[model samples]
Target: MGHPNDDTDKHLRGSLTKQNKKLSRLKCSVHNYDWGIVGNNSQVARLFALNSGSDIDPYKPYAELWIGTHESGPSFVDHGNGRLESLSLKTWISDNPNLVLGERLLRSGAVLSAEKALSIQAHPDKDLAMVLHNSQSSVYRDDNHKPEMALALTEFEALLGFISVKELMDVLCSVPEIVELIGSGNAKQFLLVNEQYRDKNAKAVLQSIFSQLVLSSRNKIGAMISNIKSRLLPEMQKRKLTDKEQLVLRLESQCPADAGVIAAFLLSYVKLNHGEALYLGGNEPHAYICGEYIECMANSDNVVRAGLTSKHRDIQTLLSMLKYTQGFPEILRGVSLNPYTTRYLPPLDEFEIDLSILPQATSVVFPSVPGPSLFLFIKGKGAITAGISENDNVEEGEVLFVPAHTEIRITAESTELHLYRAGVNSRFFTIP
Candidate 1:
């Protein structure tokens, strides 16, 4: 038999240990950015309304819905006591890293639901992130490279990466203002260099054009926009506009005077249908033009913005950190693990995503995960009958945390159940 002192010691140790539940519900944090779609039209706002079970204000601009342990918008654990505990996700995970993330995912953190156009920016690599974080902690919060993937929740539009050298050359030749920015001599030289280096070093050739355009003067940019409007506006009204031309018109509405208006022509414009995905590595320059998507990044919030926003612009840093390359954008559809589930796998070891769409009154069993998992219910109602959490009710926009190695069985109530799971894949823990 244990002594009274021994029993007391055990109790104290239990209290000190993490109070996290095995399959606890999560109370996520939300960000109201200026770029967010106004009123209850915001998807983030709708999700928040479902979680709170209240009437949406319809006027608040809910820009982002964040889930995970990142300090910027850390989610809170729901203890099911009719009250949410004050403990943050990051601190809670730190208290029991192995239980939550296991060994692989302990290094990474957080997921996001972005509503409107995110800033035109790129993340620094790991080493550069560290230097930036250390030097300017306020601006660069964490020392982690953000290799993010976006699974389109709705039809999403973004300016991703660089356009082809030949295409860029055509724009340069066709637009008098673009020709003026780099001068006739340099433009001709760039074309010649592109022809010579197209097969060998395309990225370098693309970089030369991008650098000149990005570094152009405000007056030059103004002239370029004016010229574009004068030349293209009449044609835009007469015929079916191309995607790139449409983007120019959209940018004209948003920020006509901004240099990004000119810069947009240099980048490839992409639109992802619902359920499709896109992967962006660190140092890639991109700007989300519109629509909603689920964004998962490697636990960092360091964005070096160049333009298309009212926020602080870090043009020099952005120019210095970009990975200049041109290619047709690849839209990832994910690997289908089953009829009901598809897994989106990016190159980064930090995170991966699985989307499940269950039919009406159907039961689906998720394969046991080797690491901690985050599940977000996007559509319909469901009851999760999983290890340690029996008959737990999950509805649209509800978030859940499933501990490592826990068996998961979700059943649709009366309608289809749609959810996405993010976790560290088994590859990270396996010794190859």
Candidate 2:
């Protein structure tokens, strides 16, 4: 398959000059992790195949499509001279920070497509991140805190934070295996505290119980898992299982007897329809369980994992770093910037995403923002014009990087265009 942007490159080579080139097409990188959806079944694989003009392997898992300057999976851009992969996006930003990043800092953006559940994990806060990075540089690669948001492109399922104390009590009363694994005495103490305090002491109580659950011996966890499966199998045959029950079975199938299978009951299980979003700040324990979503975070790759992975696990670090907040994660429906654009803004200074749904033959002009923006076109065909640059032809799965202070105009051709624009949060900096 030929590169989709080959003709666009030829047009750019003749028209663009260094002084007027504020927007250029980007070639992003894709990661193939075990949890990813396989081949073209994955949005990541589809987009990557289109952007890179590569043939898909049906057997391969396509996990993440990264569009940023993060060292783990950096993006490249065409410099208008027909060299599509000549310069790294990080190097371009470094060479022109004032023009590219403006007053804002770097951020990481990606599309995550999961087939199976991701690891039960938490990202560290800034202080902990710095300590972890200094102490274990190989694992905690960066010193920046990771505050992230996931905007669902498809039906998404995840476990985020601890469930409310009342909810936890209900699970404990029902799931005897979990109580047994955590020990009958500890479970009784947790139930007593929740019953009396009514969640006022949720953090302390949850921390104690969760610490015990996570610290349980592998043998005990495995035995409890077997007992739960035996109990649930009859229910599965007789009646439809609850979502949490179904999730437990599914996680067990993926990683049989893994501690995450037992630990999952403690966290809030959430299912998001398309366009709904979830925010996970630093020290929040969460796991992405099936589906594809657009994700943006602070530029870091530090994850403290305890279970559901073949990767390195740091149980002590994960237990220490978690916030132990108890509740369901709020699902963001997005605020409308216009009829064509909806913004998913998490409560963080790192990044925010604007989703644009442009109708066919319609044009929308976005005024200059204070920071650089990465535009990912997930659907439809369009032409984008930014600053003094000529219109850049865009199609599904293409990406563009627009520098700071550049007004962008996007015109949808024959179909409605769906794209996500990721940028630094405007609240973080003042335009001077």
Candidate 3:
């Protein structure tokens, strides 16, 4: 009514707004705060082309995948406004489930590809961890501990569950010098009961015997260990201990008598290569990540960690949650579908990932009708060109969310594509 050209201008403005909303705009950078891990305290995960460091550099455990939540390392995605802001992935998924998990959103299986073995420890059972964290004033983030599944992308090793009272006795008795630590009583019971002697009794015996044995070619404790062990481990020597066993010996040398390593061995031994994963939850005590994979889980920022680096050592808390029984963690693998699509399954419900590896130039359809989804380009390069011609490329670690009701199409240009898709699905039901 105001002017004849007003309707055309308004239509043009609406077109521009739709174009902007559907345009592909995403970026990534190596997590700098996640440097408290790796070889030293100063190691920073080198970032790619994107924003620069945005936090304190002093924090030691400095390696992180900046995707899901955690404001410190959230994936800075651009919203409708040209201005870029951090998006909370957890909330994003919860708001839109159809395009993410479809009908299987709740039946989620987050996958992990470790570049190196992580730590040998476990998160508490949900309630226990909650109570522990709730009771403590210093702990940060949510009290609901993470129950993760570690699937090895390569030859992976982990200490899953506890060693039995009997198995522990056998491993300790394997060395003659350690025999006295047991001394008539149940070695396990005595160490737990006798406070004054606990440190000096068993833990010390292990340290003196195992750590010293591998200290060097010539050492006091090492000499004693060598002398005592040759007899006790005659059969072990005859069979030649495994490489993992050798690695264990080396770790023992570094932290002799550490209950951590002893606890590590009590769990099961696992090894995997490409296309393999270890499904571990919070209760499973394993530490080591030696592969590269699409890692996804509930938006968690709490890690009840142990022996792997010289960082926070919650010895009592870690030990208190451990189950001293023999067990193993389940492993998940990927199924190749035409080299453009791969399905993965982990033993968890917090997250799931589907790798769509497209060759040359082609289009693929993902019928995501769940909630919201977090997608990334971890290999090759490609883009999801929504119906309006908006295109966002898939490059190493570049992520975006496929909101519910968005049936998108993606195509590669001038190269093969490797797309990493992951997100959280919260509809979980416990077996009664």
Candidate 4:
């Protein structure tokens, strides 16, 4: 027979053990937005199905797999015993801030295999975000500014920033319907100023054209779209279309008569192959067209959308918020961190991403980071060891939360493993 105090001691010890766990498995959330890829075709669906032990429904759309403490789709800690605690990830972090060191970055994986494009939108800068959140809390969900980076998992296409003045001028000359829509006066002024000054007044000119396109009457936009299709369809059949023309046609088919079809021509068209990435700063306009990617951003959901979505459109706000910088956005191929790892560090203090590809029977040790991180295994099998915790058999689609200053080592088991680690940018903190 044991002492009566033994049970109490065991319970206390158990609670302490749970509290001292520096690495924990996380059960992430999946959003089924209409823009997501449908069924097994979606990487989001595959990951969700793998994590939840649920079968994939062929008709359902699986859009985003969220692995953060965001209020909208908060993740949960998985206790490994098939039971979940009532506290969400956000609540847990709030309750135990010391463990995570008050981290505020959000990480998510996305897939866009649908016909429709994402919204033509720009996120507010910090000051504007605070004002928008305070003035219109219902529309702008959070006060944090969102400067994001998207790392391509597959072939990805997007319209990012404004095209160069020369490219815009060429587009204007080629597409007469755009001239008709923006009015001959504005078009002529844009062409004349660019030809004379050579981009000295590019910002003002781009802003004028974009504002006119967004504010155009729906009937006028529809008529212009019809005329554009009539003119372009014959040309498309005769010869290979330019990337801009192809995008216009694609957007038209996806959301007919939307102002974004015309607005897209003013933006730089970007296509990224696997392992590539692009950074989107605040107030920069962009729209993801298709493919799978892992995205990391500051903790915010505030979007000022102009067009190409069924969601709310803040035309005036979007027009006012744009940077109106004209050029090709830079594509990133992450800097090599080690033989098995690469790091994608954007020019922001909020967040960064590290990708590791480990072959079978290989082991890699990651040094301690300044803040908490969300580590996700997107492919194959692995094992992780951190402090006293050992995930002996981590499978694909598993997410783990690593506490601040906790070093972790991963070993690929029988197959090659692909992992992405999301955390605050290392430059934000000093590593002693």
Q: If the candidates were sorted by their lDDT against the true structure, best first, what order would they fall in?
A: 2, 4, 1, 3
Per-prediction backbone clash count: 1, 0, 49, 0
Per-residue lDDT of candidate 2, residues 376-423 (tens digit): 999999988887678878899888887788899999995799988888
RMSD of each: 4.9, 4.0, 9.7, 4.5
Clashes, model 1: 1
Better of 3 and 4 by lDDT: 4
Q: Is candidate 1 or candidate 4 better by TM-score?
A: 4
Give the range of the ten consecutive residues with the poorest summed lDDT in model 1: 103-112
Q: Write the per-residue lDDT of candidate 4 for residues 1-432, one digit (tens) a residue.
A: 122265654553355356644676777778888888889999999988888778899998888888887666778766536555444566566655666656667433332343247889999999999999999999997788988899999899899999998897897789898777667887777777635575787777678878989999888899989998899889977999888888898899888889999999899999999889999999999999988888888878889999898889999998888889889999999999889999999998888899999999898888887688888888999888886565667778888787787889999995799999888888778645
Of the candidates numbered 3 and 4, which has the greater TM-score value?
Answer: 4
Could you arrange the candidates by TM-score from highest to lowest? Answer: 4, 2, 1, 3
For residues 1-432, write the lDDT of model 1, one tens digit per residue. 122365654543354354443576778777777778766777788887776556666777777777776566667765645356555555556666666554344324333334445667888989899999999999998788888888888888998888876777777677677777667886677667645665465566567656776677778777778888888889877887777877886776777677787788888889899889899988889999888888877766788888677788888888888877777679999988888899999986778888899998887887676678888887899889777566877889788877777888898885788898888865676746
lDDT of each: 0.75, 0.83, 0.49, 0.82
Off by over 4 Å in 2: 1-20, 102-107, 185-194, 198-202
Quote the lDDT for 105 in model 4.
Answer: 70
**Model 2, residue 430: what's the lDDT?**
60
- What is candidate 2's CA lDDT for residue 127? 99
